[model samples]
Target: MDRQKRQLQILDHVDLTLKEAEFVSVVGPSGCGKSTLLNFIAGLTPVQSGAVEVFGAPPGGTEAPLGYVFQQHALLPWRNVLQNTVISLEVKGIAKAEREQRAREMLTVMGLDGFEDHFPREISGGMRQRVSLARTLVDDPRLILMDEPFGALDAQTKLLIQEMFLKYWEENRKSVLFITHDLAEAVALADRVLVMSSRPGRILAEYEVGIPRPRTLDQVRHMPRFTELHDAIWEDLRGEALKAMQGRA
Candidate 1:
């Protein structure tokens, strides 16, 4: 199907038998339709052929809920942290007091306890992304689709947030479809990594990460297996990445 910015054609199909509480990372060269796959799962984009499912049924046909976190954070500047987190609940018709309480509790988990009243403008980039994460968790969704949620953060802050995210993921246990260009990030966080090739993207490779849980970003950096996997994937990606850059030139 045609996307506004990119197109997707899933062929020789592969399906994710995603069990509950699994974290899966998707990586690909630019224009590989990584985010488009998420949109198809979210029912924001239609599948031209083949089936797409969420919670054992077609996405839009089921009662399951999905939360999305974008690269931009997308938090409202006018709203304080707590209000921003609760806005989704409010829109879903949840009671005001209950939604506020739940939203604050969610923020605390992301280490934003005292910053509940802070507006987006008043917070640092990392903190804003935490608030964005808190907002997604507050909805108590079964599935979360993250599209480069931490891509904009500084390296130090990205490491910190990545660690914090693992903790949150371990505790809450939700199925996630995380999209990223960072190969290291994919290996560190995902139970399985799906790599896609450039434009009209298709899954080129899928690797299962057997690493144990509570793996910090720093730990993943030092693991031999991590390097092995990283290099193997990069060997495939380097060509695609170079091709993409050359096309731009």
Candidate 2:
């Protein structure tokens, strides 16, 4: 397919599967179709070839709920944190009181308890992203797609949110497909990390992250196994990333 006067071939011969409650992370060179893959799975982008399914059905074909947290929080600025979080439930025709209750519970879990009534403008970017996460989780989706959700935050805030995210995932065990350029982030949060080639992206390698669960980002980094996995994947990713940069230049 052509995008903006250029033929944009995003995926080629890419076959992937995510088991229930699996956490898989995809990392690749810029413009290597990481986000594109997520969009396809979420049914936001139309697929011209090959099958894309969730829960044994075409994307959005099943009754299973799906949640997405994008790089941009995409929260409605007019709505307070609570109202923003409950928007999905409201769309599903949930009752007002019940939606509010659920939203409050999720916000609390996301560390946004006292900030519920605060507008998005009133909160920090990290907090806004937390609200975004709470919004997605409120529906209790079986599958969650995150497209560089922490990419915009400062390092400290990013680390904090990452830990919080790990906690939530460990507790709920929802299937997640996380996309990021940060190799460490990918390795730390995922059960498996997939590396992709540049341009018409394809899976170049898949590395199983054998690090034990109930993991904190700090603790994971100290492990020799984590370093070994990160280095190995970086070697494979480095060439593709250079090619992508050269193409842009």
Candidate 3:
């Protein structure tokens, strides 16, 4: 008989709560298990030794409606823009007519209305990300887990997409757990911002973002409260970030 080996991963002392229709953001240094936290909640991986619940039940249950968007836009090359947006609904056995109408409406909101027939490769990275978002939002999951969904884009495009994302979220108000390395982005969009320690990750600190709702990127950035929250979170994160860098070094 051959012996089997198993690998173990741990997230130490992590505790979090997200309320109904709340948008929470998590920020941390690299390799701090920020993405792992999202994955665990989304039930992409099994939860071990911790009480993890979504909607009063353990994660991964069919009753818990959730959506996840990864950093990479995992669009199918073969699918056109409209086709990509409706794939999730199609999987759920939605009728073609209803799903198409939903996809079209979502694409229009995402500013991809004119490029419906274009394939993933035919669109810009920003547009592909929009389609990815459209696909995720088309199903209207009660909870959404996003892992640095805009980290790959250039600065300008990232800002544009961030504003667009906030617009949708403000309107729809889904419970979102957004994971990002960008502290400002975290503060800009979240009701509460969580900071995590280096590997063997745990929640180090959290700041309640006091900025008003219905926020615009330009307006919110200039507010004193936004600066206050961002700076406080950064102070907590800087040491852990340095530790991560030194560990890598």
Q: Please tell me which predicted candidate would have the highest TM-score against the true structure.
A: 2
Lowest lDDT block of 10, candidate 2: 1-10
lDDT of 3 by residue, 1-249 (tens): 546745545489898989999999999899989888887887788887787999998888888889989899999999999999999899989999999999999998999878999999998999899999999999999999999999999999999999999999999999999999998899999999989999889899888887888999999999999888888888898899999999999
Task: Specify the highest-lDDT model's number.
Answer: 2
Tens digit of lDDT per residue, candidate 2, span 128-198? 99999999999999999999999999999999999999999999999999999999999999999999999
What would the per-residue lDDT of candidate 1 be over residues 92-195, giving only the tens digit for each residue?
Answer: 89999999999988888888989988899999999999999989988988999999999999999998899888888987899999999999999999999887
Clashing pairs in 2: none
**TM-score of each model, paired residue for residue:** 0.91, 0.97, 0.96
Better by lDDT, candidate 2 or 1:
2
Clashing pairs in 1: none
The number of clashing residue pairs in model 3 is: 0
For candidate 3, give the lDDT of residue 170: 97
